[model samples]
Target: MDSDEKDSIKNESIEEEVEEVEPARKKKKVSREDDHEYTVFIKNLSFDTTNEDLKECFKKFGKINYALIVRDNVSGHSRGTGFVQFEKKESVEICLNQAGKIVLQDFTLDLMPALPKGKVKQIEKEKEAKKVEPKDSRNLYLLREGMIMAGSTASEGVSATDMAKRLRLEQLKSSMLKNLTRFISRDRLTIHNLPDSYDDAKLRKMVVAKTGSKPIECRVMRENKPTPTHPKGKSKGFGFLSFSRHEDALAVLRKLNNNPEIFSANHRPIVSFSIEDMNVLKIKERREIRSKLNNPTYQEKLKIKKLKRKENRKNKSENKPAIKGTRKAPKQVEENEDAFSGFASKPGSVPKHRGTFKLKEQSKIHEKSMKTQNKLRRRQKHELEVQQEKQEKKFDRSVKKSKISDKDSLVAKINKYKDLLKGSNDESTKKQKSKKWYVD
Candidate 1:
């Protein structure tokens, strides 16, 4: 072949290769441009919502390429948001237009146009740049560069001590915000106007899905008595939930309260802190009062009062002159003084007790009789002990006799068994001798 023909053919082949490569490059460019246009970003999604649910919700708009629920890498739980890509860009526009009105799985969707990572970053930077500063800018400080203080060791930049102080202040501010949030929330919540279909399990699940925390207790208040039609009792359209931590309760209240779309209920559910019962407060106060009244100090005070009252009665009796009709005989007055010393001490102070001398003489006689009765009881107890010992000795003697009899019986049985064994051995030996004689 000629050199000129070879060069011409090579030039034509190069032109064809360029033509093939240009179309593929153009196609890639077109695909890149359409990537963000057909995809829709969804916010405020329910955690239980799945990718299939997302596709089913927006299938009416256009053909879906795929739907995805963003999930945590470690836990594999939904992040409460997702993305949906459509075959046509017009479907995404339609979905975004009906964003707030669309409800899927009882959750209202907040839709936005999906953007590339670089574009999203650029938009955020622009927003930060466009933010208007306060009119009195002198109060604002920048962390990167600020006026050098007189005490700063570094002449050109912020000192190490100042940096440390700034970091400490930031930490304190963050901690204060966390504590403030905790204080703002409550452990128990009262929910009003709940749906008829809602029950304890559903309420707990909803709270867990919203807050990622389980409630300590959850219940739906029902009718006092169940009717034939409603065997489980009809719901009163209210419920309560108690959470372990204030943050969980706050998260549930923020996410579920006043959001009718969560339950698709006709009315907005009201969630607020549960009010403590007045009866409970009264019971607590009554218990505290009862405890105080039964205290040792109060008991001692009561005993002191009784002693003072007795001393006061004694003084009153001593000041009063003896009346003619109330005068007692000398012997009777002495007996009265002895009997009433612990109570009133003075004679005839209390006429409730009469015939004191006769009663004292009878009490002395009764004491002598009681002592004699006790001595008789002690004698009876000693006799019972002696009888028990005699019975025990008789029982021991009988037990020894029974043991001797059992031993004689066992010895006789052993001898009889030995004689029977010897007879059997002699019979076997005779049979063996007869068999040997027969063989010979």
Candidate 2:
């Protein structure tokens, strides 16, 4: 072949190689950049999720580049949706394969490719716009639009479309009403002094019979442990019952209050019922019941006084002073009439003196007992100090013994090394002298 032709052919071949290699290089760079851009949408997340939770959940698939949970702006609760990005394509595929296979808190996870960022932002904006309208206005608007979509007005007869729309609207209204009514109708009935063996089901049934509806829920009050009462650990003998309807709750309250059999003779039935909106009643009842239970009554005070008087009589009889009766002469009385008359007091007068004296003696005895208690306390304090000192001394002695033993072992090791070195040197000297004689 000619040289010019060969050179032309070589140039063409080089160009072809360059074209082929450049496209591949570009493709590899593109792929590497796209790897980090891949994101997965995770659903059924917990409402209380944090960024750390999202990272931990996606960490099993691959190195999580970033993670975030969508949150409500006002409520600050997670919206149960989030995104996780990975730096590897294989990780994305693996996550999708196990999408619904993973479960968290009884909810299955749903993983899919994240939608475009524009679409997500658009959806969030729409949601925010919807939320900005007042709730009542929003509901009325929905109702009106729904009716229009149904091809009928509230007064006009419903068309076939209207019937379908009405059904849908009714369902929505029912759900909304159910949620709204929960806060309005139910009342918390706190029945105190309930028998320990009282059956919750039976009580609910009884309440239902009286109110025409079963209680929505019921729970037994936990015993004292600082629960709304004194004598911590004592169950106030009561529990709470939440009714499904307010009328039913009020009816139950009326019947329970009027029934005499419900309360013991000494203790009246203390049935307090209040709507959830009126939480102040719970606080008030707690204070009132605590005060009534702790305070003493008028009858109790009188009984205590009688008991104290009886105790006094018993103590006086035990420590009665002996009195010897004596007769006074009339002539001596006449000689010092005024002085003698005062001395010749009636027996009753002497009894009063004896009572006063006995009271003073009792007071003195009580004071002596108090002093004896003080001395006993001092003695106990001295004994405790002595015991503590003895324990400290014993602890110190053990510490010193351990230190002394450690020192002795170190000294013994040093002395043994010195003796070995001296013995070895002496032996070496003797061997050297004997070797010199042999050589000569």
Query: For candidate 1, which ten residues in a row score worst on lDDT?
Result: 138-147
Which residue pairs clash within candidate 1? none
Q: For candidate 1, lDDT tens digit of each residue in 260-321?
A: 46654334555544544445658899998899797979888889999999999999888877
Model 1, total clashes: 0
* Candidate number of the best lDDT: 1
TM-score of 2: 0.22
Candidate 2 lDDT score at position 396 = 100
Q: How close is candidate 1 to the true structure, as a TM-score?
A: 0.23
Candidate 1 wrongly placed segments (more than 4 Å)? 1-31, 123-440
Worst 10 residues of 2 by lDDT: 333-342
Give the residue spans of candidate 2 off by over 4 A.
Answer: 1-37, 121-440
Quick one: RMSD of model 2? 39.0
